[model samples]
Target: MKTIQYIAAVLCSLVLSGCSDFSDSINTDPTRPGVASGTQLIANAALYLPGLSSSPKGEFMAQYLAETQYVGTSLYPQESTSFYSWYEEPLMNLQAAIDSDDLDAGEGPIANQIAVARILKAYFFWNVTDRWGDIPYTEALQGSDNFTPVYDSQESIYNSLFEELKAAVATVVEGDIDNDIIYGGDMSKWQKLGNTVRLLMALRLSEVAPARGKEEFNDALNDGVFSSNEDNLVFRHLPEANNQNYWYGQIVNQNREWWALTETLVDEMKPVNDPRLPVYGNPARESDEYVGLEFGEEENIGTEEYSLLGSDIYAQDAPVYLVTYAQVRFAMAEAAERGWIGGDAATYYNQAVEASVEQWTGSTEEVADFLTQPGIAFEPGNAMKMIGTQRWVHLYMFGYEAWAEWRRTGYPDNLVEPNGVPVPGRLSYPDNEVFNNADNYEEAVQRQFGGDDDIHGKVWWDQ
Candidate 1:
């Protein structure tokens, strides 16, 4: 009986081992690869880009909108903010697609995919570096091989971004791209966006590196930037609740009355009869006219008295602009004013203001009247201020870009801070960096701003 039992156990063990081997053999099919395609990777990366521009903190910092309830972010406080998502998600996925075996073997033409990824990666890095002065660029996103990446100077990062943009625009090849939400795999649009982004980056260096800025700006303009409203780089949000516009999610679904139009913004627009004011905000609850609350007065102000975000902004399917023709035209106007380009500054300025009005109102009638206003007209000596202020108004919902521009140009200069606190210049490094990447964080602070992570410390470009 014992011998028989032993034989049965041995047989059962052998059968289980055979099944395990069979399962392992059938787990992978050679015809169906498990790796994500370049197209899919790019689509995923594109989804993350719009969120950077959606943060309400940016609007608060730029003084476009004031907080009604929690005003912590509006009044500058030393808080750590992490930008690891830029590296961990889209950038990592893009790198994987670039390194895929199918791409290298020419299963599909990889040039276009590579170009798009490079351009987007450059954009993400540019956003990150602009917010926080220096960041991990050269040695970043290398998993397991390099855990602690050194921070690269903002200057070096910008230089590398310029090269990446140039190569990306120049390397477009004939290929079919899938899952592209921005331009539906249109290489021409992607090329234009790349050049447009290059133009923006070049303009950032106007004060710090004027010669290089002029050279790159001209190169990008020649390569072709955004030409019209059709060429704007925008992300169209879905109607679904999970994928609705950020403002929709905040104002409608969340049932929160946190944001109100700022007095600074309303005062500027009301005097000039800016047509975009109605499009930008609804009338105040107490009165039929548009009214805004002062920044950092949440404790004193009631939510129902001030105007909330416009109904158009709460629509689920609203499009978020990554880059707009209005912005491009304004950049051109500034470039011409600074003698970086040959066109007349006034022409570009008028075109920019008109484009901005038409972009919201879908007509040119209101623009002509607005331009005739005293301060609205383009003055050669005050070209920079005029362009900067109009750009601020044009970039209404695009908070991050607006804040960056405000810091750089100092237009709309009289931003009233609560409690006599000055506006923040840069966000501090995330707390995780202090605990995890301590040495690198300390070194970055020491080298960049003499060992203090103060919000008032200006970035290299801002100087």
Candidate 2:
């Protein structure tokens, strides 16, 4: 009894003595930072912005590339997709940056840091809502405070994104930011990018919300956006293995023959003698001629028989474009076609084509020749179709944006799936949401998609 009592007394004393030490050390991870600076957080958030833009699935879905092997994603399957990483990692870091007050000490000016975070947050959230409609927005990223955030309607989300972007543009102040991988802390470039994002978002609502789209589109243009390729928002990849381009990682480092140019894109480029063809793809090994595999073809096609992605794209340091002046020009052309902006639609169209070609080839001779072709030249009646098709072509490496535009415009309307299944309108909600956030997920589906988490269910703006 005495020995037991003695042991208990020693244990209690140790617990009492170690409690403060334990508390202090429990959250202290030597290798990990307890609190990253605002700049570091901004850098972290910027890193994730290019993920979907860099992914092959977006290209495959847009019919820019056909799968040579492992064709599961090419054929639409009812699969769960998640943007959880965006919310959990970089978005969290961005939130921390916005909420941090240490900017005056070393982390850039408080207003600038917060403004940058808001722009990035809007960018990430825009991607999320586009991929999966009715996402958790206004109440999202609240951490444990609101585990089951109510999903905000896509319309409401768009409204808030516009407001956030406007505020972010207005809030830019003089400050030096660290670890700014995108713009190197250039506030002007960041402002342009924010406004450009707004422009793209505004154009997305053209069909469904024409009046609102026109207002926002003009507002973004007046606010200032990308004017030239020099103003492109690109994430320049490093030569190191960890930070190399996605195509280089997949095609060179992994030694995978997983992707090939699609006939849909090559067919459009070939007859027109498009200069971008050579830049977009390599000649096939067998024929030494540019040939693309038809997307969703059931026949076993060898990678060598079809053209591979261009060597420039497979380079270790190829940059991923988030927004380009070509895209902005195309948007303007479309806006002009719809009478939302003042300008000749053909002029903007020609400029967009020239910009896209020059961006790839760094010369105008081929573009001039290509533009003079009968079918290639801009026509007033067919302006919308011309704009949509050319926009798809210009958005070659930017697969997600291309796919989104295709969904919106339906220009290349002849896309066919081998299985006879229709193209997916949106990606299904993540499996984690279905399993963990069951109630909220159900509510979102019920309210937005007629009680089904279906890929074919169109988003609000798609109408």
Q: How well does each candidate superpose onto the true structure, as a TM-score?
A: 0.91, 0.92
The numbered model that scores best in lDDT is 2
Give one digit per residue, the lDDT tens place, for model 2 in 1-463.
3223223322332333111123355656565444455666676666666685888778876888888887776888888888788788767778877876565446567788889889998998898899898998888878778988889999999999999999999998887565577777788898999999999999999888999999999999999999999888887776765566878988888898788889888888888889889888999999999998988876868788999888887788887877899999999999998999999999999999999998888888877778989779999988899999999999997877887898999977767676788878998998888777889899999998899899999899997
lDDT of 1 by residue, 388-432 (tens): 999999998888788888888887687887888877888888778
User: Candidate 2 lDDT (Cα, whole model)?
Assistant: 0.82
Candidate 2 residue 244 C-alpha distance from true site, Å: 1.0
Model 2, TM vs. native: 0.92
**lDDT score for candidate 1 against the true structure:** 0.81
TM accuracy, model 1: 0.91
Where model 1 places Cα greater than 4 Å from the true spot, the runs are 1-33, 104-108
